[model samples]
Target: MSDFLQTRVGAALKDAALAAVITLLLASIMVGLRTKTEQGGLVIVGQWGLVAWMVGVVFVGRLAMSLLIWRGNNPVANAMNAMLPKQDTVSKIGKLVGPLLLLFAVTLPFYGNRYVIDMGILVLTYIMLGWGLNIVVGLAGLLDLGYVAFYAVGAYSYALFAQYFDLSFWVCLPLAGILAAFWGMILGFPVLRLRGDYLAIVTLAFGEIIRVVLLNWYEFTGGPDGISRIPRPSFFGLEFTRKNGFADFFGLDYSSMHRIIFLFYLILILALITNFVTMRLRKLPIGRAWEALREDEIACRSLGINTTNTKLTAFALGAMFGGFAGAFFATRQGFISPESFTFMESAIILAIVVLGGLGSQLGVVIASLVMIGGFEVFRDLEDLRMLVFGLLMVGIMIWKPRGIVSSRAPSVFLKEKKSVSGDLVAEGEG
Candidate 1:
């Protein structure tokens, strides 16, 4: 036992020593470079900031090595390293956390300022869009680059219907969803046999076609001028406009802030619904069929799963959600234009899904927050903002090629306890 302990400790110390030496060499090179590259006629060592940074790096490296060597022999440290929360406990915590998050989202606007509320709404909107795309790309393994086309369809559908028929937002909303779903099925048909890059290219082309059509079709779509003065959502025959609505009804001074808050909660509710529905679907037989098809389409067919129906359903459902988001966007902005639905929009949506783990809801939320929220936050930086954002994305991919979140599928089956490794047990016995 003493021999084994000594061997492990010695090996750890050797590795740590090697790592420290490499680190020290790198630090020295950096210091040398800094010394050679004079700034403001000052030497490298003369720069207090640079010297302090280099010294701190060396000190930290040595400290880390010492800690590793010390901990190598400690039983308590070994046990702490091996410790992990039980699966049941993790699941319970997730169950609790999800609802609490939803509640926070719902009520955030009531307490937050107008700017914060607006940002929250934007985040939730993207979160919904990300989750919707997740269903097609993540669960169904369908690469849809033309998703923004469906969004455009929904927005335009609402705009046209409202303009021509004088319909309410509530009516236009579902109509837009249905129209988008129809378009989704149409897009899905030709790409049924396609996979990977080919599917991506085809979808890309489809999205471009939609945008081109909207650009050229002036009479119906209003072309470059776009549609404006589109109606905002109304509640119980009361319009949200400042002139005559809730503000006066409640005897409070009217402001756009209230409308912003209302929209925030409206989208929050929509996002929650989207999340709930997708989660429920994943547990159902149809959802399982999608997952199996994603894993292996041929095998899914061999198992008697209807590949055509599964594919269509995934496309339709994803498009429907995109449509819902589009309609909301149209109403929220009170405008529609060809520029709103572009290839860039599709790319950003895809990035959200990919950067988030493919099938993770929480990951989608985080990714949307980071991507969309970060973009908005960095808007003031202009060109530099995009450069930095691109670099940040590159860094994240290099660090986590799979995704920021690794686990995609929810663990449906009961987790069995893992047995100790036979080799480890044998070593212990010896």
Candidate 2:
């Protein structure tokens, strides 16, 4: 017992020291840079006191966590385990909760403040992006870091057509998706022979290529200035104008919110379509081929699957959904810019898929809410927001390394259904 106590104390001190070092590395720059001063000629001013305070906090907190929460008989772990629902209960809760959440979403505009409604639209946008990327990265086991290229394609497709052709948003929407899918196929065919890091690098290059082209092609893409005044989407034959429009047709007072509400539902329907198509496809032969291709390409070839076609289809479908979301974004914002489609956007979408637990639709939804919505909640915190975000992510990784929902339900189960451990699946091989 004496030896065990010594070990725990030693472990606590070790963790505290490690935390202090990391805190110094991360917080030193942040705290040191917090001072604001007007200067034509700059002076290097740093807040050493703030840095010291941050390091002290980290050391104490880490030591306490290591000793009381991480070591043997951890109360935090015990409490969490106790609070967690049984495996069987999860499905029951989902069944009961899914519809409730949907109903809340559908009715949110009526009851929610404008700010809340706006946040809802933003969250749903990322959710759509996450679901789209889930197809390529999660279902098909492709490592695509340039998914946002297709998003830009879709946006540009809509913006260009609407600009030159005097086309309605409805007309441009499908065309955008088709164009993006074509680009997806183009990118897909060339990268079919590559896998793992090579595939990721190729995709990343493709994204940069698209962005650079847009940046240089000033006449065609408006260069860095971006396309503006892109028409907002309207209800069929009914604009949401203040007079003689949707509000007038319905005999309701014209509020700016009508347009916002319409965009919300439009994206919602599109997201649902993406979800429905993905779910239905999962039951199809092509979807099974994707799962097989993900697990082991060699085994997949041995089983006579056309790996090339499978990969292309996954890319095409994923790009199609991304295009749809991009078009919606263009319509909602009434603008399209090369700046809007960056590598960071792709990173966030991919992170959503990985953090959500690959190929789990519900997990993607939950992860989107937590990541995107949670980030929005921290907007007031400014620089501190990122610090909190990093810590929260670290905590989650420590607690559930596989993700929030790590256990996957088998695509085809025998008489007894069982949850497959995430460890059993290869990366992106959901």
Among these predictions, the greatest TM-score belongs to 2
Q: Write the per-residue lDDT of candidate 2 for residues 1-430, one digit (tens) a residue.
A: 5565468787688779998999998887876766555667556678888889999999999988887776658788688677988867976786676677778779988988888888889889888989999889888999999999999999998988999998999999999999999999999998968988899999999999999999989999899999999988889979989889999999999999988888888888999899999988888898888887888988999989988999999999999999999999998889888998989999988888888888878778888888888999989999998899789778878877877777766667669767778888776422
Q: TM-scores of all models?
A: 0.76, 0.88
Which 10 residues in a row give candidate 2 its minimum summed lDDT? 35-44
Q: What is the C-alpha local distance difference test score of each model?
A: 0.79, 0.87
Off by over 4 Å in 2: 1-63, 73-81, 428-430
lDDT of 1 at 293: 75
Model 1, 1-430: lDDT tens per residue? Answer: 6574377555555555666567556656665345545667756553445645665666666556555534555665566556856655755675686678777787787688888888888888889889889889888888888889998999999998989899999999899999999999998887867887788888889999999998899998899889998888986677766787978888889887878888887888788888989999998998887777777787878888889889899989999999999999999989889998989989998899888767778878878888988989888998999899889889978866655554544336568534222122110000
- Model 1 pairs whose backbones collide: none
- RMSD values for the candidates in order, in angstroms, are 7.9, 3.7
